[model samples]
Target chain A: MIERTATIASTVGLHARPASIFAEAAGAIDAEVTIARAGDPVDEAVDADSMLALMSLGVEHGEVVVLRTGDDTAGEALDALVTILETNHDA
Target chain B: MHSFVGVGVFRGRVIGPVRHMPPALAEPPVGERLEGSTAPETAAAALKSAGATVKELLQERASRAEGAGKEVLEATALMATDPMLIKAAIKLVNTGTSAERAIWEAGEAVADTLKGLGGYMAERSHDVLDVRSRIVAVLRGVPAPEIPDFAEPFILVAEDLAPADTATLDPSKVIALVTAGGGPQSHTAIIARNLGLPAVVAAAGVTGIADGTQVFVDGATGVVSTDPGAAEHAAVAEWQEKASLLSVFDGSGRLADGTLIPLLANVGGAKDAQEAAAANAQGVGLLRTEFCFLGNSTEPGHADQVAAYKGVFDAFPGKKVVVRTLDAGADKPLPFLTDATEPNPALGVRGYRTDLTTPGVLARQLAAIADAAASSSAEVWVMAPMVSTAAEAADFAALCTAAGLRVPGVMVEVPSAALTARHILDHVEFASLGTNDLTQYAMAADRQLGPLAALNDPWQPAVLALVQATVEGAVSQVKHSASLETTSPKPVGVCGEAAADPALAVVLAGLGVSTLSMTQRALPAVAAVLRTVTLPQARALADRAVAAASAAEARELVRAGLPALAELGL
Candidate 1:
């Protein structure tokens, strides 16, 4: 498992458009991905490709969410996802 | 030939075969009766079928129902399965009647019983009408009996039409409409005039003519004839051609006598602003800001508010956009507004009154409008809704001004505001009358309820009395402030349904209203109406309107009063 911490950078946080975008990107990769807010017990786990699951988490801008991925290409997926979140997907 | 006349809601002269709507689609047949005496089993199946039909109908109309309509539908669905209707159906089945016949008889009996119970049944009937119409339309395989198509521009005739049914018209193609079963203030009539289609509602015997019969209809005269003589047809055609030519706007909102009346557009959102700009409207007269709060549980934050405001402001760069601050309350409830509960919400804390209870919400909204104005070149003017007294107007003005926003106006939607307009103008830059609400309040009529609909007359002397009071207050304010040159004259504007109405527009302009703001779709027709009369002529029309007995009479009087201008335009 590869784990990393990323800060939300989308202007609208994780509510509408940004949440959908992040979920789409996560789901494209073949890995089991889980996200949790820092120090929060509740974690959202999915196949890394479901937009609905990501939106249901209600992640917002400036919040630090921890991500964990487990798969053959877990390292590459983790690095790419962290970079996207950090840049807010250039939104 | 049997002819039924209703109101023509949309413009279009169509000639099509009469297609009655179908009954509701039945669900898969419940198992057949096992024997000759299976009353209970048959009753159960019929009840199940009715339940399924009601559920499907409710789901179909869920998105289309407005706030009150939604609640009414849910209540109606519950009533559909009420014990009374079921019991009646069972009794009929036990007597050896067929399932469909039993259900129909039970429905009629229940309808009659509930009619005596009053409002609930009336509302349920409306739902039933809606459901029945849909089922009928489905059965007939017609596109909901929309405006028909004729080779030549002609008159459309119908028995009755839903607002949704009326909305499906191509205004450019339709000339006029005559209906058999709608009152003057019916949604069909309102929508007809809004679309610039001359329509006569409640015209009895409109549908008596056979299909494909040539008909001559004078929408202005409420006259219709089947297979009119050649001369009559020629005259009608000539009049329509002349009217079409005269409805053109010359970019400058001026009459032949050169009286400049700024024609503005009433917009609901950013898209409407763009449409207004495209249509060459002078500017926005009323930019309703309530859409931002729709479908939400909490008041929009400052940023969200700013973004929405900015969208409108940006759409009309360098043009005036008057933003009415969140004019929400009982009539338009927001899920986030918890304290808005009231039996008579229309008369309750709404518009500016609701703001007083939640000052923070108002402040945030005002601040966002200010911030949006600062960011865009669009000139933004802020207004408040439902200011009944001068003090409320003054306080609202102070808040907007303090926030660096140009507080151009307050809407006089209440009769009290019209009565106290002079005092209210003391605090604000200008005022606009929301005639729809003012007329409702002045006549003590619930505008939403259909039976009290007669009292919703815009031309009732009582309503004109309020308008007269508002105009008098405005004139007095202008005169008193004339000496102070720094203080610009408080120009009152009419920014309501009344303003969009071409006939009413003349009356309003004559009543000392400097600007008329109406729906963007109405700007052209209103502009056409403005070009037909001078300020003096408009005033004369207003006088006639004030003296008229009914709205129809008032409309006729205004049209008659503007004969010369009307001749020039039409």
Candidate 2:
């Protein structure tokens, strides 16, 4: 599995437009992607492809979150989602 | 004809066939477990297909919307197709719940989570509920919910209408609206009046009126008379003809004797300013500043306030723009500014009272208004809300002037200020009567209480007496401030729902009010009715209304006094 940590860059966090954008990106990749707030228990991890799950995480700007994927092409999927979560979509 | 009465939102008469709104869809049935293992798979497919249909529907709506409406619809669309919601629903179905029930439960679960987050995230619960309803309809093989459109004019009958339901309504096709539910202050009522549609809100048996039944709606009297005969039809036609004739008398309101009454618009922000301008509002009477304070955890900085105020001021260059400072208090408790747990926040610390305790907020806001005024050509006037004493009025005026604002005024919404209007007016240059709150305070009725609606009528004798006192005080005080040769009464305006009423506008004028500010849609009718009477007749009506024993009696007396207005605006 490939794992990476990224700071939420959207001023409004992973909700509204940013949540939709991140979820869409993750949904497009062929992988079982999961996300959780940094230091959260493994059971707290939610499917990255689900807009509701991403938004329910209540990730705010500058907050750190972890993304993990079991697929071989995890690098491409993580890069796309990390780029989405790291950019201020609202701005 | 059978008649039903409720509160009228505007003055006008409309004759049209009834068109009832479709009822809200039922909730998914509970406890219907999946029949077999394959039931989960079938439910998953249903969920996906339903989500696609909803997404498509929202996409179509978003494409047609503009500005904020477009943003809201697009955001809702994204929620409709959220993969997490679908996966959650599928999981619930796998747990032996019916597909429809699973979708409903999963949507509620996520919505509850968002609601618990509070603030902006909590607001997203509405979007989640809206998306869930759409998906549930698809699963049930029912058509998606929408406000119906017609090829011809019809009276819209509904239990109640949400903002989205009414936003896209075709004004030309909807002649008038009669709702079985909703009060005078409901958003549906406000929008109907804003759109110039005669509306009767809280009319019992509104939904019971047969479809396509011809009805005569008198928005002035809040009377919906069904199955009208020839005589009623003729009266309606005559009123309509007169209304069309008076449509030519637009612009500044005036008395039959040519007394000028500046009709200004009460606007919320830039968008409302634009609408007011389009409706030929002479100036903005009440530019509410609440929009700036809403949705902010901390008080907005002077620059943010300046930018927002400038947007409104720029819309009405060279026109009078009276802006009220943050009216926040008990009801709209700002976490950063107010005590959320304060008992009786309305009566305790609100309006100007809050500002006195929390000086920084008021000071910054005044500075912002001053900046906005310097940058725009509109004649900016600043006012304080909930001023109960002459000293408070003087302090607010001094603070406003210190910040470089020229026209300083105070809102006469409290009984003490209204009772001693001359004393209060002596401290400020202008006074705007907020009749809604004045009625509330005078009658000791909570404006939010539906059962106490009778005491909250602007036509209540006590309420009218207070208004009369304020107007007379303004006239005397303005004359007191000016030279002996300049005998014009100090400019007193009515900026409330009462000012929008044609009959009440005349009474206000009779009581010496100089300007009238209301929603733009009510301006034309008010202007039309004002022209039908001389200054003396208006005073007579005011005297009659104020002398009546009760609100109902006062209204009846005024209606009897101005019988011509029944068909004059038509």
Candidate 3:
């Protein structure tokens, strides 16, 4: 398990286009990934492929979310996903 | 058949064989069903197969158009993958139906879905229409139909036009369009105006006319004459020539006696700001800040807000940009404003009212506007919406002034504000009548309810009475303050649907509206109307409009008062 904190750079946070883009990128990696807000239980596992599920979490800007990935390319996947989340996509 | 009329949106005459858009494309070939297969199972399999074929066809088209028509193809691909349509098909199929039947049923179900989603669905519908058209063409095993050629320019009649149908139409060859369905703000109406084609929408029986029939569309009168006599044809030709002449003047707006009125554009975002500048709008009259709040989950920070304001300010260079702070509430619900509960949202705690309930939100927004204005040469005037009382106006003005923002104004939208305009003007630096809301409030009618639409008419005497009061208050303020050396006259402007109406523009200008702020597309036409009448003539038109019993009568009275101006072709 690896832990990292990143601010939501997308203007609209985890919703609609941004969430869809992040979910698509997360699904491409061969890893069992989970994301949660700080202090929230890890049991609330969200499939990174579902935009609706990601948006249901209501993750907002500057809120820290924990990302745990268990796979050979977990580090690469986590880095790429975090980078995408921290940048505006709708533009 | 009973006849109904609508304002013509495009111009051209088409006489040709009628070609109705073919129904849903034939379903993809399905594998033979096993004997005694359950209806549900067979339906599911067939639907799955149909979906796969649609997906495959879209992918192939996209790949083929990758370099030359990538944007168009990509939009079609989105339609092909629309979850709503796919879900509707699945639901229908699961209830037991052939794939072809299910697809057709789904298409019918989603046809009205676009109407409920506003701008987002309007855009999506364009793509869906494209996909449907392509599928129909494929099913027919024919190339996409060529633009229909007419021996002479004739009217193009249709039941209703999807945006895609209008997209491929050639404006030059199309003289006029008449439709049985569509409203003033419908996609077809907007597209017709953009193409400079005369059109009349919601004219019943327009599509029922056989092909090669002679039709005369009078856009201004919203009348369609089928198989018109020679006299009518000659009159329409003369009107068309006048309309062509009116299209020439577009630079600055001036009244008949040469009184200059600044014609500005109302923009909602950065893209709109750019378009306004490109279209020669003197400046942005109303830059709505609600969009930034409505689309995001959290309040935009000072830096974020400032950046957005700066973008618009920079775009106009040296021109004035009036930015209205977040008017979100009831009518436009922001996701982050969870506590903004109202039984009647339109008349609820919104505009400046929200500022009192949500601490720091308005302050932060004001700070951002101030900071942005400080960096730009363009003047930034900040305003608030939904203000009904003098106290609210004073409070907002004081807050903005304390934050070092210049020109804090209040939108005179509520009837109370217009009725007591004198009190409100004493506190704010300027005022802009949001006529749409004021009309709704004055007439005690819900503007959105189609049934009460007649009562909610902006031209109603009651509505214009409130507008007159607001203007009188502004005039009184100017009179009282004109003698004071420290303060300049506070100019009153209008930013609403009424401001864009060419006929109403004359009335508003006559009623002492110093500025007219409207959509970019409407500026040129409104400016032309302004140039045709002097200030006194405009005032007389407004007076007559206020005395008229109905919108139609008011319009006619104003038209009769300005014969030369009418010839300018509004």
Q: Top TM-score: which candidate number?
A: 2
Off-target runs (Cα >4 Å) in candidate 1 are A1-91, B1-182, B194-198, B205-218, B224-240, B243-247, B297-304, B329-331, B338-341, B356-359, B448-455, B478-483, B547-557, B564-570
lDDT string for model 3 (B156-243, tens) is 6776666546645766667666767665545556566655566677776666666665566666667776666777667766866765
Candidate 3 docking quality: incorrect, acceptable, medium or high: incorrect
The DockQ score of candidate 1 comes to 0.02
Recovered share of real interface contacts in candidate 1: 0.00
Each candidate's DockQ: 0.02, 0.59, 0.15
Ranking by TM-score: 2, 3, 1
Worst 10 residues of 2 chain B by lDDT: B242-251
Q: What is the lDDT of residue A70 in candidate 3?
A: 62
lDDT of 3: 0.70
- Please give, for residues B1-570, the per-residue lDDT of candidate 1 as tens digits: 223344333332323233222222343233323246655565557555654566465655555677744644554444444444555666766666655455555555545543433322222344443433333343234443345655555555576556645644666655566666656566657667666676766766556655556666555445556656666656666765765665455446665588887888888788878877777788888888988885444567888888888988887788778889887765566634524336677878788887766668888888889999999998888889888888888889888988898765798889889998878887888888888888878888765544555677676767877888888997778677646664445778888777766777788878778888877766766677677788888888888888888866886777776664345433
Reference-based lDDT, each prediction = 0.66, 0.83, 0.70
